[model samples]
Target: MVEIDESHTSLPVLAFFRSPQAGRSWVTAAGLVLDTANLLFSALDVPRSRQVELTFTAGCLAVNRVQRFFDKKAETQPTELRTPEEVAAANPGREAFAKVWQELRDGGLPVRPDEEAAWQHYQALRMRYAPSIEFLSQLLLAPAMGSLH
Candidate 1:
């Protein structure tokens, strides 16, 4: 199952896929998580991918748990959500994500440890923005988001 306490960068992805969506089952959601991970892993090194790997593994694991619950709850036709294989096969970024997600299925997702200094840089950015975030919260406003991660 997904570790609920995953890194902040991937937290939103984890949160979204883990939720029970209408029409979509665990299968499709898991792929979406991978696609997002592939995107992040490909683009962002400034924030490091620690949370990326952590949350990807955690998110995939969480989605995995939803299938049985989905199947058991069916009244007539069980939700015909696409399988992970189907989703992976059809996605545009399959070149990268497919290998990873498939490996994930067999406990093959590689763990790339985030550099300690790089992680601290993101933490430092968040700390620097803390007051601004607090001010927005105090005003009942959402602060502008940054790429702290």
Candidate 2:
């Protein structure tokens, strides 16, 4: 067994990489949806650029689904806010957001279709209304195989 050093700055990231059952259920569910989206879209005779667009769109949907699940969970369970402020108060600086993102990704909750659609629209607005911030967030949370695995 790889003894994961919990003290590492990337501990939250490692938490996400651990067994799929341990953390949030949303992450795994979103991953499944993304995989399905990829498979479904790959068969279409779309242009490469279109395919990439579709993939990014699907990913946006999947992430929104995850967010909805967490939102609902927060409503029912009423856990502490995992926002940057709260996380920063505990861990400080980038480490806080990193940890929160890891927690959100590892939670593995299920997102509904409606929620996914809403998220897509929200993402579009963000892209249009606040391109720089949206782009920065994307840069911060660049998807990687390890995040899903």
Candidate 3:
């Protein structure tokens, strides 16, 4: 599991895939999160902020690359939505993250530790934004659509 350091404000984001198959899974999961967030934000009348756009684009690119990999594997299936619990359960290539962190701790890695810390920050931000996302999704899909104003 990728462990977040509580003392740090940033969360470390790591992508690990020894095989192309695992890579696809990571990409798909990330893409789903970003896409869902985007739709929910837009529905809630949230402006297209630069951070949101960048996140959305990164998700889409990941999805696209994963799709290409799936094509190579001759697999076909629609994207699936996964909950945070499911994501954690998958144990998706987190060891790579640990290795990178270890290297940084040993002063062998060139990347600044702060850059890795950003992942923790992102996670915190995600939690804060989740309520907004849910509210927007519900507001957009309400049956009467009369109380949104």
Candidate 4:
């Protein structure tokens, strides 16, 4: 695995490492929500250009969705937040999760959605939120695939 420090990466990159490590693998990737303007001041080796800026903006949006997924905390968030489309698409998965959640007021056998319902809800969410996954995946794979110049 390639080791990169703060100098070479961003906060979202660090968060990926701090995340749960259930299985070990030789491969890992960093999906960063980067700052375009900061690159000029921080990483001298990194590019400072319009395309880089735009890419970073897109990364910011993707990571924001990811952040809201992982963090339920209420606070003043970045103005560049997740789009309505993202939320709508992921709602089925959210509803499926809500149905299966262990929380109960008057407990019984515990509510469980039917297998087909669960599967459909989950698939909907996954398909909708897949771009975020793809973005992060490509970010990590680019160097390995020799697509990064």
How would you encode candidate 3's per-residue C-alpha lDDT over 43-147 as one tens digit per residue?
A: 223355787676655554444443343334434333335455443432322343345345544654343345345334334444443332233222222111111
Compared with the true structure, all predictions reach lDDT values of 0.37, 0.34, 0.36, 0.35
Q: After superposition, how far is residue 82 of candidate 2 from its true place, in Å?
A: 10
Segments of candidate 2 deviating more than 4 angstroms: 1-48, 73-149
Give lDDT: candidate 4, residue 120.
49
For lDDT, candidate 3 versus 4, the one ahead is 3
* Residue 103 lDDT, candidate 2, scale 0-100: 47
C-alpha TM-score for every candidate: 0.30, 0.26, 0.30, 0.26
List the lowest-lDDT window of 10 residues for candidate 3. Answer: 140-149
Instruction: Tell me the TM-score of model 1.
Output: 0.30
What residue pairs are clashing in model 1?
A: none
The candidate 1 region of ten consecutive residues with least summed lDDT is 140-149
lDDT of 3 at 29: 41
lDDT of 4 at 29: 37
Off by over 4 Å in 4: 1-61, 64-111, 142-149
Question: What is the Cα-based lDDT of residue 148 in candidate 1?
Answer: 15
Error of 3 at 121 (Å): 29
Cα distance off (Å), candidate 4, residue 131: 2.4
